[model samples]
Target chain A: MTVNVLLLLVIAVTFGAGITLLLERSLTRIVVGTLLVGNAVNLVFLVASGAAGRAPIVDPDDPSPMSDPLPQALVLTAIVITLGVAGFLLAMAYRSQQLQGDDEVQDDIEDTLIMALAERDEASQSWEDDTGGEPDEEGADR
Target chain B: MTTHSAMSFLIPLPVVLSLLGAGICLALGHNARAQRVVGIVTLSVVVAIAAVLLAGAYRDGPQVVHVGGWPARLGIVLVADSLSALLLLTSAIVTLCVLVYSVGQGIVEFGPDTPLSVFYPTFLVLSAGVSNAFLSGDLFNLYVGFEVLLAASYVLITLGGTGPRVRAGSTYVVVSVLSSVVFLVALAGVYAATGTVNMADLSEKLQAVPSDVRTVLQLLLLTAFCIKAAVFPLSAWLPDSYPTAPAPVTAVFAGLLTKVGVYAIIRVQTILFPENHLTTLLLWGAAATMVIGILGAVAQSDIKRMLSFTLISHIGFMIFGIALASHLGLASAIFYTVHHITIQTTLFLVAGLIEIRGGSTALERLGGLAKAAPFLALMFFLPAMNLAGIPPLSGYFGKVGLAEAGIAAGGWLAYLVVAASIVTSLLTLYAIAKTWNRAFWRPPDPETAPPIGDWHPSTPETPQPTGDWPPSRSSPTGTKSGEPWAPTLTAVRQLPAAMVGPTVALVALSTAITLVAGPLFGIASRAATELGERTPYVTAVLEDGSGITR
Candidate 1:
């Protein structure tokens, strides 16, 4: 089995772009990234199937050259899985947009506090909020 | 059950039974009682089967069942080793308890045909997924198992489709989807490097592969599992997402889910990558995960969020045991895994009771629970102390076992890890004590007492005429405080026996673990020994020359 440089380059570029999109703040970009990464993974499986030749059919006497069927099966399963998760991600993004007018996940209050403390390099302090303990009404409304 | 005939049938029974139960429960969605019965009965049967499988595997070594009567390495196989059987049993018990707890919560449907009606079925499917992952004999099959459970979890996590749940669900889904993608990529890499995805075959082939490639493959698999496991660095998503769900949902997720990832890591590290190339990395990661996780726990004012953080921290202890790569270490890890699962689930269940009784799990809004419901306080206290590694409890035993293993390893890093684990344990005690002081022991001050009607079903709109505190459920919404803490007892009396029963039973179960620590540790040691040896599993699955297909 020989590695195909052209397919390798394509797979690398696709993965890189997909990861970059995943890191972006926009939910739409993340969804797109997921799809791209999904496709790139499929490509990796395809490349792993060895140099493409025949449709992987089993026959006793007619064996000239046939591609490995396992990677194709793996790719097919991956595609289906990606589709399932991608559809869910898209629906989530759409719902967020409809409700909040933006598709970004706001960091939790505690998460923000942790980040601030880390940046400040402060010792662990009591985080007891004195705002009279009620659930975050703003969060509940949103 | 000791015979091969019984073993084979029992080995796959839990997964198959759970899936069938899920299907049946889904079909009976409109009838809530029927759904509840199906879920409970199915889980109980699974628990029984798991117990038998555990005993059987212990007696006869690993048991394998091939699907469709196909030969091994070609068809999906489910193997019930002592380790898997132990995991299956623990998970089944936790799932059953949580199911009862959810049933007690009164099965509120958000709409006529909402997903809440399907919660029973989804929960069963999640259990099936977990069982499948534990029993799977192949990497690809394990991935399938992970997806199965994950899909069910996605449905369960967003059961009410409330605003907070949906938001949390979205973050959870995105993170989970990314991890699955990474897992797929890793599977491809494994198959590419070693021509098979069947774990038994790969374990043999992987040994012959080059060192660098093997390390990469191992690390890739570890990354996927780590994200699922919520180890530090990849653990940011856990605390944010776990707290918003309904009580039973959160409880089950806390107990059984991350342990599945830890199980997978133990599987790969012991059976496949026996060379221990990444022990140092694992140790460092464990230390950070423990320390950082506990710090996050200490920082949280909310009970559920704090438990979630501690959950991550304790996972570090398990990783430490696995890192040692010794018989005693793995055994201790196994024991600790079982102990933590029970303690964590029990703690969360108690927290749920707190939410039910006190109207909130936020420590700032909660007080005087010990006076209101001493039973609930006692339930919380046992698991809380156990989790903090208090002596004479299972948690103490597990921690001692881990520390002994660390000292036996006799390295500076190991010593550092031991010291960190001890500190984390003490800090965990401090965190739990702080929670107890605020939520239970302290008297409810009239000035700061949470207003009434926060949880009363009659008034979804904020309470009326509660003096100074804001009527808004959100604290910042109102500029006041009042005398509502007195009426909390009325809600406490309304607590359903069904909800309280399951929690009491689970706490009793954890106490039973402590009582029977001797025999339990023996089982853990045997399982760890068998896992360390590795050949028993290879032989059990690949007997009769059912080696690599390629």
Candidate 2:
């Protein structure tokens, strides 16, 4: 395969996975998506290092091959780091689900703000909404 | 044979010690007491190593060591110059204080068992990461160092997995991940353009690149760093996220994380891409960060949240020093960074103590603390003054040096910095005053107070749900009593000695820095010179001539 074609395929798959993950509400799916994106980036890096080259190992007996060793080394480090990070992310996701009773992350700030505003509006209307001769003390307390 | 070669071996000692310490911490994970001891002993060793490195740098210029006998271009390199040594030393000192403080606070905050056991190892790993970032010579290695620390930080920040903390942690995680991605993308672009990840090699190669391409590289790198540093438009996540962490975690994050970002910018400017258009961009960003950050501080009613905003604002001052691209400016920035780290952490510790003694961190719920706890008041006051750039304080010296450097840089940009510094300092003072009034000076309202029992004069009546004051046990009638309040004062006069000791020590250290500003500034100036001159760093790594063909 041509280097350009392989590079384009890597990019397409990577972005496809990323977009899929972005649309999902499940934390596990999002983590998987992140992993896919990471792999795609690693692939992009490999291609950038000149894809046509042979492996970087030096063998005097074989003279025709030349692979760029630097990208491979870089990719190795990136892969290890990505694995560690992904593990941590999964652990966090598991913990979050256990604690919050849901797999979907809460947009707590937005939800709280909406709830607060609704409460305030309810509070303002409480005095005017009373149609009876006298409001019950317990009902008026809120 | 050269001084640089001898210096290189000594420089990595601290990092190695920290890593070893981290391993020991993990090994002793089942025993909390042993882990604490190991942590303290390991950090003490780090402090010693930092002192040695500083002395060596002072005596023998910059030192560079290539890992595993590889050449500079192909191998990972570690450089310990004046700038790195200074930062390493600051990290050691601040971490030591926080560790001590945590010994007392951690038990209360995290319950003495499993949580703290996890916390110790992670904290050490974070320290190791900071040490690595300071010492690393390869761009890729720098990236690794950043990730090491950042990953640890994510766990620490979200330590308890509480609802508010998790919500905050998610924002922090997403923003941090996005920033890391930007950094990775920039690194990829730089490697593609230069074909080498070695910083010294890239420095020489980057000059040959087209100006426009270089500009793009600069922006990409700086954007990532600015986000990490919590600069202006990029800093929105900080106030929301930072206040949710435990006190020690927040203090360490406030002191160390953004400084690492600043450190990266300083390193890149001096070593790789000196004299670029990025300085102008940094200048504008610094001004915006200072103004916007302090304005955010003004709007906060929570002590820790307000402190978080000020933390972001002060980062602008550090960036301003670097943006000047002059020796004086960079030196002052270094000085300011060191000073700010100590003062900022101390302030957070005091605020944390206030929260422990008083029920809440909110301004509305806390009051008359100065009367209730004199020692806490004193501890909070000194750092507050220092943070506000009061005369005879280390903060003043740092601000003065930065402003002088700014003027010396000589342009409209310099004027903008001066104005921003003035405005930020004044606003910082205003914010601190607000905290003082609400948290210390004002009387606790009866309706909002935590329930109080057996009211002693020393114990400000913890507020009850009712709008009436709790009756004084000494007074039969519910009227005011004439008995002395001295016993109350005696009872609440001191926090546990362990908590009090670290703050007092930090405050004294800050004061000492101010008193010896001349010698400190001289050292900072030398560090700046060593940084600006990249030849020593490059030569140290490449001098063996065993690796590179060219």
Candidate 3:
């Protein structure tokens, strides 16, 4: 029921930067953004575990409370899963670069075609109408 | 008591068996025959396990098992209710058939004798992930299940490392990873708010959180899942990525992946947040998903991309049922989910067959398919109509049930959604008919025409695979000079019997749903009742102490 100001600020900073990087067209940058965002979430889980406390173990010398161990377990699992996904994305990015000379995300063939079709449809009633046949349009897909 | 205990023992077998099967297959990587046998046997056993779990669940309410005999409050518990059990069986059947189809079609990118073919192992892992997700009784485990499947899918989607696939695979991997990050954030929020990630526990505890904070949590969870589900605003990734994969991969993904998201949505909405606070927003999303998705389909010139769009569009119908938040609505949604999974998969499989016979899935590049291969035509025609929700099909029955639920809800938004759904169905029919006309009914394009003026598959002999895939668009053989085109019928390499058999079996399974619609709907409603009421699951997991006490 309590909010930690410092932790909140840190979470906001990291999450904000992650979202910004995520918008880039480069797949590597996107993967970096995903990793940062993942770390920020782990930090959120840390904040959720509450103020730091004595180690959660059997102890006779001290009566300090034990910090919640569940969130720590959750964070560990999250980190491992994020690592595996990051590895896969890196492999894909490397493959992309090797094949196309760059790791930048390419525009979709169908999406570009759909946009062109939309433009032509808008000019359907105009005197300067421009339209093409299926074979030519499909050629544009490649 | 005995039945409950016995059922609990069997609940985790699907996930455990699948993971074990995956490890076995991976070890047998160099041996193709051994890998195939292990993969199919593993899935077959899992199917039997799911069927047994389904019957046990029906006979004796929900079954629960706590891992390592740990207390329900402390450890993960896997639960098998009618809802999860039914989906598990359907998915297992579909996965097996797709595996058979994939092997038959030969997705062996590095030739048949490559030292390491990653296909079977990756597929088994994907099934295990799906099984885990369906049976997970907690939010964190659910997230893990999603990650596992997404990871396996990342490998499957880019199998060949070819230019188009790698490019498409990049977009897909990034988007899916983003969704997983969002899901992780939601898990953090749930743990922070409720202090436990278990669903039955959360169901009781989430109600106590402040309404504003609770709304934030629900919206975060919904956002992550809707992205996975490919809801309207977030759906642009799906059509772009799906069509680029090999055919069998596309078929399996079309069948199972998004439905996992739908299953999550249904679980969370029905169990964790019983009050349905975001009904209006969900209805709006459902309406938009249906309209825009089918609109994209109508605009597509390629068969694979067109089917991908319709896949997104049909997700709307399930969301409509979920948004209604009534017994009948949820039941109809479950029924529709099952129907969509089977039929969409069938359609994609047929699209693969189309690629083999015509050398391309583009409507303009294909024609005279009906004359060329009658069985493949029938395969495509049946699923297309069924998808359009024509009367007498399971799809039609599901839509009617959803519409009835919408009317019963009787709000203007509900009415608008119903109207939108009807419009979407008509648009689906239009798009499908357009594809049929161009791809099957009309004569083969003049340039790629058969040499004997016309030809059929059964005439004397057939031909072979001439690198027709990603069909070679640069060469128009006969059109260059005045030389007539050659007649090449490779069985479409005269449509391979092994591949065609599975596709036909899936199509027949879809028709079988129409025949058995009454009982399936009955089971669906009973499951819905358990879901809507919420006591059966909670009691089985937290209250009844079903887990063995060490």
Candidate 4:
């Protein structure tokens, strides 16, 4: 029971810290955060595999507990995938730094402007609806 | 083996052939000629195989193949039903066209950052990934498929290693990785709850789980898939990142990639969780995606960015149909998916041609293209009109079918989405028309015209006339290669037949959708009916009596 509790707590802390880092603007921090989150998820899979004990080799008469090997296999695959992605992330970061000398992701100009326009459109439409489609009257009141 | 047994080979052939093709393409290295020939020939064979698979699936229900002769419960299974086969065929066609188009763009080399050899291999791998995802019968396998494609896309999107491409590439990679993580978390949860990731097994096991737990799992999966599908709030990365890639890369990405996510969503809702517990959530999402996506499109001055936004909007149409969770809704959505893929790809290709001729995709600096290149003008006009749901086009047939489905559904939300559908359609027309009047119809004003210099194609064989245009200014590397707001200096250079021919072929494919809408709709309905039943797929894979187990 204590082991399970400890594992759960470790997963929580790791995932929380990882996600916090990912939300930061620095590209290096983001890459580290991805690694951390990936490890945290691996730990979760470990915990889900039940009480760990031994390698999952079976003997005909063995009566001892064996760790569920499935999650370990899953964790191994996950780790490899994370490594591949981390390499890609590092390459992308290097290229980004080379180009702009910084790792901050800039907001797309068109995206922000379009989103703002959408908000304005929504506000105006509501106003027209509130004024029973009399937009001139609504504008005058404003 | 009899014909029935032989047909199972078709399920994995496309993916395997494409992978083999990628290997050969890679070995060809900088030999651009060999790579193009290999890509075209390999994809053509894949297309033929896909057509056969589609016909076989339609005639004989879903066909299941287990790799290495293993049991469905223990091994990866590839299932070819009407849905996946249809997608496979459509995507194969689009990718082949885009490959030929890229070859025409003098895309043989791009300095040290991106080599032409890398493009074909990566593209083929991406196609293989897409096919794998569509045909996967299990969740973990599906996740693998997503990673394969996402990794290939990372390479393709940042092909030139230019500044904007890198920036956009990073954002794309981050978003995709985050979604993959979400999918992983959901996969863990699903496995913990039910102890299996085989979707057919989950279909049976999920019912036994507590309702609250099942709902949580369902929502988690939906959230992950939604990010990938670029539905609404999660879609900001799409319009930002997609417009940065080379034109052919962008074209194929817009056409086929998101539809893979939608395919997964349909599989999730129908095969794994058929209760429709999330219908209301999906409806609200559909309405928001449509309205917001088109609104974003309206605000974009750049042609590629506008098309990207519109791409997001039309995904809503598919989601809208899926939200209805009815036969007609699913059928119409399938039809729309096919129509949208062809039209969207053609539009992006045309956008590429326009950029080639005019030197920029910005409407502000482009004019007199109608007079300059009337062929390009007609090409743009048809797809734009088709996309806006103009009559006698595939888009119109798709929209009418969807509207009918919505009315048949007959709820306040359905009515609202139907109305939104109409509004978004008109808005799409308005936006496309705005582009047309500015870029094509209007006369070239000197204020917006680019400086006149002796311009030539940017290939080595076509020698650059000595120093008329500054070499630094004329180097075509980045998305904004030319002066940001300037038009081309000379009359448009003659586009290679390789490029224009594919564009014309794709546009005709879009029109061909209308020519065969009746039979196509029939096929879609049959697919829909088969999907709604669900038992055929589930049993073909899982039931011991089916003899699929090794």
Question: What DockQ, on C-alphas, does every prediction get?
Answer: 0.30, 0.15, 0.44, 0.29
lDDT of model 1, residue B43: 98
Ranking by lDDT: 3, 1, 4, 2
lDDT (10s digit) by residue, model 1, range B1-550: 1236667977788999999999998788667677778899999999999999999889988988877777776777788999999999999999999888877665321211222356788889999999999999889989989999998888777654545666788778878888888888889889888888888777898988898988888998999999999998999889888888777888999998899999999999988888854889999999999999998898777899999999999999999999999899999999999999998998988888887677677776777788887878898999999999999989999999999999999999999999999999988998898788778866666455546543344333332232111111222112223336655454424566777899999999998899999999999999998888889988787773354544
Model 3 segments more than 4 A misplaced: A122-142, B1-3, B107-116, B448-486, B490-492, B546-550
lDDT of 4 by residue, B289-393 (tens): 999999888777779998999999999999999999999999999999999999999999999888777766777667778877888999999999999999999
CA error at residue B462 for candidate 3, angstroms: 21
Candidate 4 docking classification? acceptable
TM-score of chain A of each: 0.79, 0.69, 0.81, 0.76
Winner on DockQ (1 vs 4): 1
Model 3 lDDT tens row, B447-478: 44433324433322222223212211111121
Candidate 3 C-alpha lDDT tens digits along A18-127: 98988888878888888888889999999888777877886888888888888999999989988988888888889889988998989997688668868877411111
lDDT of 2: 0.76
Q: Sort the candidates on DockQ, descending order.
A: 3, 1, 4, 2
Q: Write the per-residue lDDT of candidate 1 for residues A1-142, one digit (tens) a residue.
A: 6898999999999999998998877778888998999999899888767778778898789868888888888788888888888887787778778778888876676677767877997633323333444334322422
lDDT of each: 0.82, 0.76, 0.83, 0.81
Native interface contacts kept by each candidate, as a fraction: 0.41, 0.20, 0.74, 0.44
Between candidates 1 and 3, the DockQ winner: 3
Best by DockQ: 3
Q: What lDDT would candidate 4 get against the real structure?
A: 0.81
| lDDT score for residue B401 of model 1 | 99
| Overall local distance difference test of candidate 3 | 0.83
Q: Clashing residue pairs, candidate 1? A: B468-B480, B468-B481, B469-B480, B469-B481
